[model samples]
Target: MSSNDYPLTTFLADHSIRPIFRLPVFEDWLFWLADRTGIQALFKCAPAHYSYSPGTIRRCTRHGIHFELDISTYHGWMIYYRRSGNRRVSDLVNRGDTVMDVGANIGEVTLLCAQKTGPDGLVIAFEPNPATFAQLSKMLALNPGLNCVLVNQALGSMTGPVTMVQPDNRNPGTCTIASSTTPGKALSANIPLTTLDQYIEEHPISRLNLIKLDVEGYELNVLQGAEKTISRYRPVLVIELVDSHQKRHGHSAADIVKFVLQHDYRVTDFSGQTPFGIHDHFEDCSLDITCVPNECVSR
Candidate 1:
């Protein structure tokens, strides 16, 4: 037997991909076969940078918004957002609406909401990582037309100094206030923390139309702290849930869904696929869920 026997599999096996192909799953078997058996080496054009720095500016072609990125890989990320749920934020936001973007992560989705909200509207964006916050500040500065107030702090159930851990240097967006028992979290910083309810009580937002949360695994805590605010405004909730991220905070998708249900809100997968009912089987909840108050939900 030689490479001519099975050129594709033999080449993939020689390059060590054969191990992945051998996984005990019919899906894996059909995956390589279902797709055309071909391989072409495309140019590796993605940028290589561990953190954002000055002099890096990207104008998103999709949304036409400028982003001074915190993560220097702007070329790839800017394109990635074109198809991701970031655009969904635009659908849920409206002109003159106020939005709170937790874990804004360099204002990726914040700018989109700002575009939908218009200049009269306001977007209060929060990012706890100091380095990332600096990039976000620069990006917002680049777009002065967008009315956004960037906050450099974590939103939780209380207001105090909180410890944030960066699980990976290459991935700054994964930083979270949740305790990381895993190793390689040598990078960390102490940042201020505040609750949405308390902040609104003092700052006094007359109308909050949306609250988009991407706080890694601290979504439940933020919700708890904003209970009063949610009850009052009942703004549309856009949340991103990752099982691994939540497990760090001792929570799960079900817990978050339960909280939303208890508050009389219904969950719709951001893509409008899954529906959360009283049955409450959230084991397969979508990564991004749009939560709407029962009163606001359309038939």
Candidate 2:
């Protein structure tokens, strides 16, 4: 039977594939089969048009923000952020502020941040992976002359050359410096790394309102690299603290919490906290930990 005649799950089950390979393999197969069987048309799809690159940009109805992503895994995350009802970022962004998006994979969050910050504000996005950077460049080109600066370099504790592991061509987001945790014994390439402090010093940024840190498990290192900047600017830090990814990078969730806390920023979970310092219990995974400077909130 043709792939269009059956569901994706049915095709995988009929083939008797292993569980781990079933999802990704079926997804890849379904995309191809749907194209071949004319099922793509049923989904209101056009021929795979390479407008900017191979990825798609879907606009969210809830938030009126656009997400430029390649894989389906990110779609769910975008939807969650759009419909979260907690408009902390959106609110802060409306007041004429600049944001730094570290590890901006293909500029999805970067675009969102830029849109929120508006034309007067700036968005400094950093992406290390060469392939992903190329895609990000193409995607940014679609929006002629945005106030976003795309930097093709990784952030770290120190500024110098470092090895970057690129896992799969289709999945360039998995690229990291840590070799042990990389999937499938992937080949690595050497890339230059820089610290936020150095960049700010060279570029002369007046103010930093928000900073989003999602460097796989290397959030702490990126934070360390920005110690001077953090101390000087005291911007709100939204970091992703995944325990598993931290372990691979020779760190832990507690380490991230401690580091941010040391900067006089309290961890008030995902939900906003009261002035009395009572925190809401948010599950610890990859979360948007907001670090408001003591001075910013106290005043």
Candidate 3:
């Protein structure tokens, strides 16, 4: 079976050997084997592609964006999941609003934000992984109507070269600049990093309305780097905070919550007024937290 097959196809092919493996009275033995080795779960997590394979182009009806992805890999599964899921991010944005997508993997959400912002608005997307950035650039070509700027660099607390670790070569979403969370064995690369303050200084913007960040567990560093920008505009923030990832990266959920509180921003889910505390656990909080400044909440 080819590794380039769509996720569904690959799934069917991989499990095709199950019948042979469970011959006649060997069903119990098969079960025992699976239980002892954890073969079922690990199979999906394994490298999806062993060689270069072309990605399939698919349209996301929910957000009205097209993406090219190799469905056999984890990255493609995420794209599929994001496509079918509710578009809460789009709802938070408005026409003519300036938006930034930090850690814009493949530009799926960035395209959605661009559509919501319209031609009068601007969407700045940052993606540091070279392979993923190349794919994002290709996807952007299909949507020329969007007023967007693509930055091929990572954002952190400073402007310099940051080491990135990707345990899965085929899944660029797992590529992270946070060294503390890096797997014991992984491929490493040096990418350019810049602060949001430095970015604004170089290309000044009158206002920044919103920012959607999904940079693994390095959210604190990115936020620290954007202190000036956050203080000035107080843009609504959509950030993913995973306790496991945060711990690996030397940050905590409390740290993030405190930072938001100090900046006069309330951390809630996309549903208005539903504070994060309901699901907040210092040890296992893994959800997208929406931070809306008090000014916007009043309006």
Candidate 4:
């Protein structure tokens, strides 16, 4: 069976698999009992990401947005379980804005941005892995009339073809650009790689409002490629920086903070209320930060 067939999720969807632990009545009863006992908070702590069949699509009538969720994979399942399409994107994007989703897995953020941007706006989503790209394309097709474009190329500091390394199993979102010094198992090669600067120069946009990047760890390469564009447009950036992931590329959060400082930007939490700086803290942790321009944040 082809990877695009989405075998596991397809099977679950058709069979409606429910083991004893997943039986709704018993699970719901347990939750109710726990809530009554004031111990539900324990259940809430680091709750394992929930998974559903591949066919879960959520529609928000109030926001006039709807999109297919990639419930087959771990990250996709968690995002769908959270019901927040691409975290904080709903807050940053606005009507008629030009936005970019650098590592758009299954087009969750892409569709949300398209809905928020309305008919007059434009959203470009980039996903390099072919299997995941197929899923993203399928999601886009399921939700029509959205002003969005899908790119099957990886964005980085240079313009050339690069191999995409994807790990085995159900987690498709872990695909990343493979480096020479970095060892990997699965090999998906010959993917077209380009810089955001070059892409923008070729496909020019008058205004860029926001950029959402979740490239696993190669955030610096992407940011370097987008330096010219960010300097030119000064768009609000939402980037994910995981310490373990960054270590693979021989860098740290402090390195990213230095880049932010060079770009005249400040790092703030998702609420945008608390501003922080790069330091020895937050080591060995996954961090999601919003990089805003022209703000003087305490270092």
Candidate 5:
């Protein structure tokens, strides 16, 4: 039969393509087939490097706010938007609290915190990589209504100059610049660093409700830099602790636990499918370690 004369159902059946109703249960199967067969090429595509202009715009969602962002940084944008559940961190977030996202990394968590906190709450995101910061800044400009403050600086134990390295990958901003006792990889550049205490002192912050630190291997120094802030604000701290990454910087998971515990905070490992109950013992080797103030334990 001629293409125009063929019945739609017959064509789809002959092509072995399932109808949309069956998609929900087998979406992954379809994606896998498409990847293997290059069937995705049949769809219209945008340039991979496309980016959104730096300006304000309204995009609707189930949440109450609309945000602006560059298309190139869409991955980061999605991470913030799709977060769900009453995770320990989410509890404090629902109360319209302030958040600090060190090593903001394209501002995904930063944007998530912004949306959760609403207009009254504040989100201070620190990203030092020039390219990532560029996209992050553009996103901030796009969402002018959110109470977000962007700082292009690295967080470390002390305020001083440090080498900020950029990897050769597409997301060059993932490069880490903190000092390494054992050499592992080389980075693109070095940049000056600052302490979180200095940042809060410079800005008028009333309270710190949450803090997320993911500085590649520099997580320990970032926590140390914010010791004063942790003591005063007692914000819930979520940090990434890859053993290999920490070892490069002469740190370990145990050391991190000691540091947070010394500051009167209780550490919890939530890397499992089910949340650990009060009686459960937390494992020390988790990649993501979340800490809450001892006083806030029963809350």
Candidate 6:
């Protein structure tokens, strides 16, 4: 109970951590952690304070790619941790290959794909959020060596202005074009929308293959709009399937898997090289999955 408590002082002296406890920086960090992660606030980090002025940059050490992030938000935190969700997409990319990165967020993964595809290859990256798009553009500018075409449009089933709802300022990557009635609304933006099929028909690439979709739960619509592209190219499909998010859009993971199967493609988890069938229970439908056309399974 006293300042000279034998056991406590001895333990601190032995470990030499008393200076750490005495530092105001440590106290400040504790307070900030309590505020940021809500360790003691009984909730997650507050999402309202996620926005910051544009042009802030963070370098991802793992992938050696410089990403522009608004550190005042959730994505900024992800950058702090160097959170790379699925690097497996890079494995599927070959030199001189053409790739479509739908829902490219700040283009971190897109950067990796660009690197893999090399200068001769084409990397079409799309980000609908204006603020996030600015960040992606900044990254592209920082790395002039990357041959990427940054598109400020939402990839959907139609070519028009589409409204994407952002739940909050915390996570810019969560924006989706699905209707609000099904999944509640957030701050909305009217973005240019184009189907992959239409875009390919108009601006034909030398070889259209290897498409990655991380468009929240709007993968269904993008796929529907890309019917012709898929039928014609049969590119490897890398997609994220969130069951709850799909339900919010009035669909299910089963529907997405069914769509892939209907196209004569077999499903597999992102990390798994073995192919899965529609009837096979995926066990985890919440992560990125690979759907390859049966014809290419042996290749």
Better of 2 and 4 by TM-score: 4
Cα deviation in Å at residue 19, candidate 3?
12
lDDT (10s digit) by residue, model 2, range 109-171: 676667777778899989987777887887677665568999988899898877777554445
Give model 2's TM-score versus the native structure.
Answer: 0.70
Alpha-carbon runs more than 4 Å astray in model 5: 1-92, 178-190, 271-286
TM-score per candidate, in order? 0.77, 0.70, 0.77, 0.78, 0.67, 0.77
* lDDT tens digits, residue span 117-139, model 4: 98999999999988888978987
User: lDDT of candidate 5?
Assistant: 0.63
Candidate 5: worst-modelled 10 consecutive residues by lDDT: 41-50
Estimate every model's Cα lDDT from 0 to 1. 0.73, 0.66, 0.74, 0.73, 0.63, 0.74
- Model 3 lDDT on a 0 to 1 scale: 0.74
Candidate that beats the other on lDDT, 2 or 6, i.e. the better one: 6
Candidate 5 scores a C-alpha RMSD against the true structure in Å of 9.5
RMSD of 2: 8.5
Per-residue lDDT of candidate 6, residues 206-252 (tens digit): 78669999887888989999998998989999999888777677778
Candidate 4 residues lying further than 4 Å off, grouped into runs, are 1-18, 21-70, 83-87, 180-184, 278-282, 295-299
lDDT of 5 by residue, 1-299 (tens): 33334344234434345333133344345435445755432211222222333332324332433434433333432322232222334444754689988888666567767877888888899888777788688767756778898998888888776776543344443568745453334543456688898888888689888888878778888888888888889998888767666766777666676788788877777443343333444344446767878898775
List, in order, the clash count of every candidate structure. Answer: 0, 0, 0, 0, 5, 0
lDDT of 2 at 272: 49
lDDT of the structure predicted as candidate 4: 0.73
Worst 10 contiguous positions by lDDT, candidate 2: 43-52
